[model samples]
Target: NNFIPFYFFVDVYHEGLQYYVIRSIGGNLILLLPVGLLFPLLFKKLNNVKRILLTGFFISLFIELAQLSISVYIRSVYRSFDVDDLILNTLGTVIGYWLFFILSMFYKRVTYRFKSNTSINIE
Candidate 1:
């Protein structure tokens, strides 16, 4: 095989999809703050964009700070501190905002249909 010896793919010790998905989803949910903050700014008729964007920035900052404490206090033997993870996590929230935009188009269509159907007079 011509594959680079130093570039080996991940070798897993954990088995079963439950562990797989839980880890994946937990990280995603942790990173969802920016979009969560943005939703109200875009559609809730509340929360100005500046406040939401500031909140997202500070939250990501705080998470990076907490990773050290979390490693020490939450799991002493399980994790290492990494700034790259913080960057990736914040980036994931941004990507999720785009996903939210895509989903809302479907939501808008469905809600319009439902509202139109329900507003008809029975007479």
Candidate 2:
């Protein structure tokens, strides 16, 4: 139950690719998207995509290693540690960085418009 590297995909070989997307890739990506989004928001220096991706990758790796350690020390196969998770998590961070950039751009435009429109006229 814990050491399934390709469990999501190989477990259901006849189930088509949908299983991989729904169970593995999509889930991993979604789980980490928030990390990507929040990191940039909290740390302005993480605005770069490369930096975010690297950070996300390291974070995912750390999680996987921790899971492995727990599984090895406490219980056998307690958590599934997969390499795919690292890739997906890093991708999620990149996506999150882009989302933040887009949202910030929109926010700036809106604010600029509102400020210009709200001018105080003193005759």
Candidate 3:
């Protein structure tokens, strides 16, 4: 159980373990990117940034706690809980939310232009 944020990062860097840093940090960040992108699209209530942040945080926290519980139950270190994972995962979610926001805005603008340019008259 590692509660210190970015603590593993410092140790890995000192040891010159670039691969570990990339795999750990990058993997965690990418792991939740889909959650951020899909949650807002699937649930209209999660369209705002604040809602996305909270959802991401709670989800990451649950995963960490679950890992801790599983490790304790198995009497082995199945996975260590790290605060940095929560931070990176939440950041990934926010990044995904922004990407979704930009895509939605672009879609709206394009569709509006298309609608405005063509008209059907009926009598």
Candidate with best TM-score: 3
Question: Candidate 2: which stretches are off by over 4 Å?
Answer: 1-17
The global Cα lDDT (0 to 1) of model 2 is 0.80
User: Per-residue alpha-carbon lDDT of model 2 for 21-46, expressed as tens digits?
Assistant: 56777878887787778888898888
For each candidate, the alpha-carbon lDDT, in order, equals 0.54, 0.80, 0.91
lDDT of 1 at 35: 64
Deviation in angstroms for 123 in model 2? 0.9
lDDT score for residue 42 of model 3? 96
lDDT tens per residue, model 1, 16-100: 4466545644574567545644665476642444544444556666765676677778767444444444444555555555565
Clashes of each: 0, 0, 0
lDDT tens readout by residue for model 3, 1-123 = 789989889998889998899898888888888888999989999999999989999999999999999999999999989999999999989888988999899999999999988878878
Model 3 — TM-score against the truth?
A: 0.94
C-alpha TM-score for every candidate: 0.46, 0.83, 0.94
Give the best candidate by lDDT.
Answer: 3
Candidate 3 yields a Cα-based lDDT of 0.91
TM-score-wise, the better of 2 and 3 is 3
- The parts of candidate 3 lying over 4 Å away from their true place are 121-123
The lDDT of model 1 is: 0.54
